[model samples]
Target: MKNYNLRSTDEHLNNLTSWLPNQTVSERLANTGFNIKYFEKLPSVINHCLPLLSALLERYDSRERCFIFNGIKCGFFLEDVYYCTGLPVDGVEVTGVVKSNNDEKEEICRMYLGVSGLLTKGKISLKNLRDRFINAEDTDYYTRAYLLYVIGSFIVPDKTGRSVDVMFLEQLKDIDKTGTFAWGAALLAHLHVELETASESSLAGHSYSLMIWAFLHIPKLLKLLPNTGRKGPDEFPLLVQWTNWLSLDLKNNFHKNLKSKFSDILDNLKDEDIVWQPYKNLQNLPNDHPQHRENFLCRTVLICYNEVVYHRPDLCPKQYGIDKPEYSGVRKEIAIYKKQRKLSGEIDWSKYTSEKGKVDYSKYIQEWKHRSESLLKEALGVEEHSGPTLSSTPSSIGNVRYDCSNTHFEDDEPEVEPLQPPPSEDATPRTQADASPKTPDDGHGSGGEEITWNTFYLAFSGQAHHSTG
Candidate 1:
């Protein structure tokens, strides 16, 4: 594997916690379903498992958009994002162009940041935001500023890593509606884009999600840490499950030890070594947990503003306890259609129909429409294997068992397979959020041409035999 380094946002995230809101504001945030109280307790510095990340990236098939672990298909899913970050999944999509003019932007800055001329070069410094809002008296403005800091520093940070774009102010303007945006989906979309370029040199955009996912799915990694006897509740937004759970070993040789142990686990990986459904027993998930969005998890496009990436949950049917179908990559035509849509000028997604939008994503729409049939087939006593096997692969790590003796995971709950809830009448996996409409002459208009599902299905029926792999 080629040498690669992770540009983690742990330091920024840890420092920003110092500005966490008081109980009143925290409660208010929780009411909005954007609780981030767990962040304040995160360790000052997180020692990421670099060796494991490197190995995973090495096996990442960018074209297929999943990691091929010993020929077994696996990748992060939308469900993983909801479980890991505790962010909402179902709501208005988090995609829109920043249409606020300079006067409007400055007005927002004055109200939230308590400064008139803070928008320097179209961005605000993290330090400036912290110093201004850390001790502000107005609870409303203080909460808004702190949220901006959290998003800029930790959630959707760019490569620069020190500043936040002013565009997010629009979302925070209506705090009550903040939770209405699918923050979890946006985070996953950004991370997917980062992973596509991870092979180059430096990694960015929420690497913690990937790290936690690895440890969760592959239990062997947890054996490297000494048990601290700390256990978080088994619930949604599962990252909270590890709050103050383990301390990082700062010794120089820690990486070397981690690398060695991870290699051993992979070498001896068995058919049952992976945890297909880690959140099977999670209790009392919020009403808006996006369980209905499961069908859209695969064969869909994830949109975070301009970042568009394909999600192929179809590649790993075992994760959902469904039988694996013949492997087929994303269709070339669908890929091209997504690319073309991305290049089209700023979209007025509010006017664009998600189910039957201007773009032709009928292939994905049909697959999602039939997702229930596949699950029903499995539920009817069809034989299902655990997953692909690695028994034929040679290994040098001798006699290692991939077990979870050192961790707090319990095996009491019968791993119940998750089924996609029946689709609603107007249910369509929303790929993007609603934005302000633009004029027809602005190059953003769809020229009054809309592709209905009937037309899309008719066009797609002829190409049904073409492989999507």
Candidate 2:
């Protein structure tokens, strides 16, 4: 397999470090719910870690949508995005196309960059954006421009790697409302889409989250590097604690020994080797902090403008201390899902949701609403131990990895319902009311399949039949 290289605009991010010390800028960023204090240190803290990333990508199972490290399932989730970057997890879905007219685009260019018609070419140069805003006055314009830079450069960059998309300017127009966008969800969705095709020669999207997640969960991996000297539990948006943690020599050592060491660690990994709940006792966050919100259980389609990806938290039940289930039939379900995506073609999710009602996520919505019931008995404050112990051996059948390429689909597999647009913007949550019944009239009949947390775990544990189109 070819080694993948990470692509980011960290240089542009570094150039904007001058604004990090501006009190006004910091206040404005905090007001928007963004944690920019650690940003200045990113240039030094962020290294390619090519070998580590390449090894991880090599083990990524697209069908299961996570990496199988020594038989333990783990992947980036929305909560990770929130903890790592401190981006808001709930708010208006950051979707919809860039509808700014040429005049409006030029006006934004003129107002922000002191240059007219720069966006006529479709994007603004990162250098021009940085140079203009780096020393500009400490006002709303500066804050908006800085946010645009963060979005285009760090949050959801395009393939160019040297320019910021003018389209994001629409969301930044109202600086105060910027905090209301579900930035964390969008970042996670973008990263998920990137990971699906990561086997290629190059991988893009915010890889910092992936690196930090590995360090947080795998103690052995972090031991290979120099100590970060973090004295206590990290604050919310844990990325801040990682600043200036790696030295030049340490990075070189990683490039030299990362692959061999990483393999050895995973090869001999034990049940206790993984840190299942790193954030459970964060010193700065209260038990009821919004950072601990259960939105992580909401398995739904994460929409970032025209891009859409599935957020399947149910696959990694152990992350929540839940008992692993024995059987699952989601392999066929995911295969049919891919086939449906192909049949549907590219959908502008924002337009699709508005024109046809919201995509039917009722199945996962109902599951998320009752997440507490799925927790392990111990997690519910019971004294006696029940369910299987963490160290209990998994079924041997779960160890056999199926070749997705050889799997075939049959017509008897469960049928997924087509989209049914709602007539109005009703406030009701899309639960049972929006779901199609498994009746013969609905075409699925009584034998129609329903996916639950247990079934998803089957797919993750490699116990499900590996079949895809």
lDDT of 2 by residue, 375-446 (tens): 212233212222221111111100001111121111222334332221222334323222221111121111
- lDDT for each candidate structure: 0.48, 0.47
lDDT by residue for model 1 over 288-339, one digit each (tens)? 5545344333444455544444555655656666543332223221331221
Instruction: Provide C-alpha RMSD values for all models, in order.
Output: 15.9, 13.6
lDDT of 1 at 121: 50
lDDT (0-100) at residue 47 of candidate 1? 45
How far residue 291's Cα lies from its native spot in candidate 2, in Å, is: 6.2
Off by over 4 Å in 1: 7-11, 99-108, 111-114, 199-201, 226-235, 249-253, 260-264, 287-298, 324-333, 336-469
Q: What local lDDT does model 2 show for residue 245?
A: 44
What total of clashing residue pairs does each candidate reach? Answer: 4, 2
Regions more than 4 Å wrong, model 2: 1-18, 40-45, 99-104, 107-115, 199-201, 226-233, 247-250, 253-255, 286-288, 324-349, 353-469
